[model samples]
Target: MARIGVLLMAYGTPRSLEDVEAYYTHIRGGRPPSPERVAELQERYRRIGGRSPLFEITLRQAQALEARLARLALGHSFRIRVGMKHSPPFIDEAVAGLLEEGIERLVAIALAPHYSRMSVGAYHAAVREALARRSAALPVAEIRGWGSHPLFVIAVAERLKEALEDLPRQETMVIFTAHSLPARLREEGDPYETELLDSARRVARVLGLDHWRFAYQSASATGEPWLGPDLLEVLEAIARQGEARHVVVCPIGFLADHLEILYDLDVEAREAAEGWGLSFRRTRSLNDDPLLIETLMALVSEALAD
Candidate 1:
């Protein structure tokens, strides 16, 4: 049986505070961030325990997926490698490594569930560029978006339901969120917002949620309008309405625990909610969750079959 290469891509994180500037520069397209901006990001990482666990969690996900595939005996052996966008062991490096392994075919999937021209699209573009540069002609499959995948919806819904178990559903407002992108993407006919909303709606329906809302979070400070209503603003509005006593946030876009979830939602949003006399709780991230691993396996299978 031929071995298939699986490339799992994610938005990377710096290994430590010292690496923040380099990581930030990479994300900014080689333009370094201001010292103040770098310090601010470093502080966020400090608050979240010195660094992000994103890299480690991603590796564990890969390991689990590989093991699962082996157990299934799916007619072909699978070798899974993780690639990060803004950090080391970059997409290109992963591609080169996989090619060196002499795999017969390739399958790529991003950790993000929602598809945005600026996000998942970029990952696919990177893969294509890498292959082009290497002159590799192996059959490749890229799983674009799986936001509404049945297993994915069920996993998110399960997490949301667990979060709501302690809160009074009647008084709790379920807020589903995703990383905000530039608002211009909408004008360009990007389905980023639509996919997020569709996934949120599916999970809400599964949980029979009556007071659910969708919001965007972690928008960059790029001085341009991004998606809205933002998460903090939504919290303020809900608090002002005096209708809901509690807010449960489900970050459906991200698949792992990282700066955005740890700092943006947990620290910043939680502070805002508490100041408004409302209890705040976010659904636990799907970091290496069994269901999430299953979802990845399913995506790889579908991509291979395609």
Candidate 2:
């Protein structure tokens, strides 16, 4: 049987405080951030237990998916590898490793569920560039997005339901959030915003939630308007309404616990909500959740079938 390579790609995080500058520079397209910016980011990491567990969580996810695939006993065996967009074990390195292992075919999926030309599109582009660099002709399949996949919706809904158990359903406001992108993408006809809202809508429908609102979070300060209403702004508005006493945040865009979830939502947004006299709680991340693994398996199977 032929062996299939599954490449899981994600936006990488720095391994340590010392690596933050380089990681930021890579994300900035080789332009180093201001010293103040670097310090601010390092501080955020410091507050979040000195490092982001995103890399480890992503590795665990890969391991779990590979094991699950083995149990499926699909005709072809599988090898799962992780690649980072802006860090070591990069896309090119993973592609080369897969070639070295003599895998007969490849399937790549970004950890992100929603597709944006700047996000999932970039991952696919990296894979193509890597193959070109090696002049290796390999059969490749790329999953652009799976936000609305049934299992994915269930996984997120499951987490949201769990979080809602402690709050008064009618009195608590649910805010669905994702990372913000530059507003310019909308002008260019990007489907990113549409896909994100659709996923949020599906999850809301699953829970029969009528009070949930979608917002964007963790937008970089590039002196330009990103997606909105921002999560913090939304919280303020909810506070003014005096309708809900508690707020439950569901970050459908992120799949793991990282700075965005740990600091941005847990610390920043929580504090903002508290300041406005509104209780705040965020749904737990879906890192290595069995349902998420199943969702990944389904995506791979569908890709291979095509």
Candidate 3:
């Protein structure tokens, strides 16, 4: 088989105090972030473990893809490797290795399902930049957004089903939450918010669930209107109504468990839910789910087909 490469990119995480400044600086475009800010961010990572499991999780993902490829006779003709936008294993390195491998074609996928200029577009930028520096032109294809992929829908819906099973059975609302983008991105005609809503509707349909609505999380209110009603506001609205029994949150944006899933949903949102006199619960992250691994392999297969 002719040589090929598969690149997977994600919004990387910091594993330690050793990495915190550099990671944040990369996210901030090399601007110096305050020491206080760095410390706080490190604390967030520390809450989950002494380090971020992103690299480890990503390696596991790569290994799983390799095994699946081998079993299906795909092999490493399409070598799968990971790159992080703001970490040690940067996209440029991943691309350079692929180029060095004498691979003639490439396929790229972002860990995030929904699209946004700020997130997925960043990965696209990495590829474009890498190709520019290379001596050869490579045929590359990227999966735009799998918000509506059949297996993708099934995976998220099943998680929602599990959440529904634990609810109190009457007037429970499934609050669909995803990371927020700046309103400017929306004004620029970025379809992130719209696509997120579309994913939420599809998942709700699959689970036969109604009374569900999308909310934004991980928002920065620094003098800009972010997408809303934010999760807290949604909880406030439910509190005012005083009728709902539970607010089950399902994070459709993130495929793996991370600080946002742990702190935002489990801690911040949970606090709001409890204080507002409503039950709070969030569906588990896909986090290396075997079915999700299959879906990812299918995505790789589709990209290669293209």
TM values, all candidates: 0.99, 0.99, 0.95
Q: After superposition, how far is residue 8 of candidate 2 from its true place, in Å?
A: 0.3
Q: What TM-score number comes out for model 1?
A: 0.99
Candidate maximizing lDDT: 2
Q: Please, what are the lDDT tens digits per residue for candidate 3 over residues 50-108?
A: 67676778878888877787677764466778888888689999899888888888888
Q: What does candidate 1 score in Cα RMSD to the true structure?
A: 0.7
Candidate 3 whole-model C-alpha lDDT, 0 to 1: 0.83
Per-residue error for 179 in candidate 2, Å, reads 0.4
For 160-190, candidate 2 gives per-residue lDDT tens digits of: 9999987778899999999999999999999
Give the Cα lDDT of each candidate.
Answer: 0.93, 0.95, 0.83
Question: In model 1, what lDDT does residue 39 have?
Answer: 99
lDDT string, candidate 1, 77-154, tens digits: 888999989898899999999999999999999999988879999999999999999999989998888999999999
Q: Which structure is stronger by lDDT: 1 or 3?
A: 1
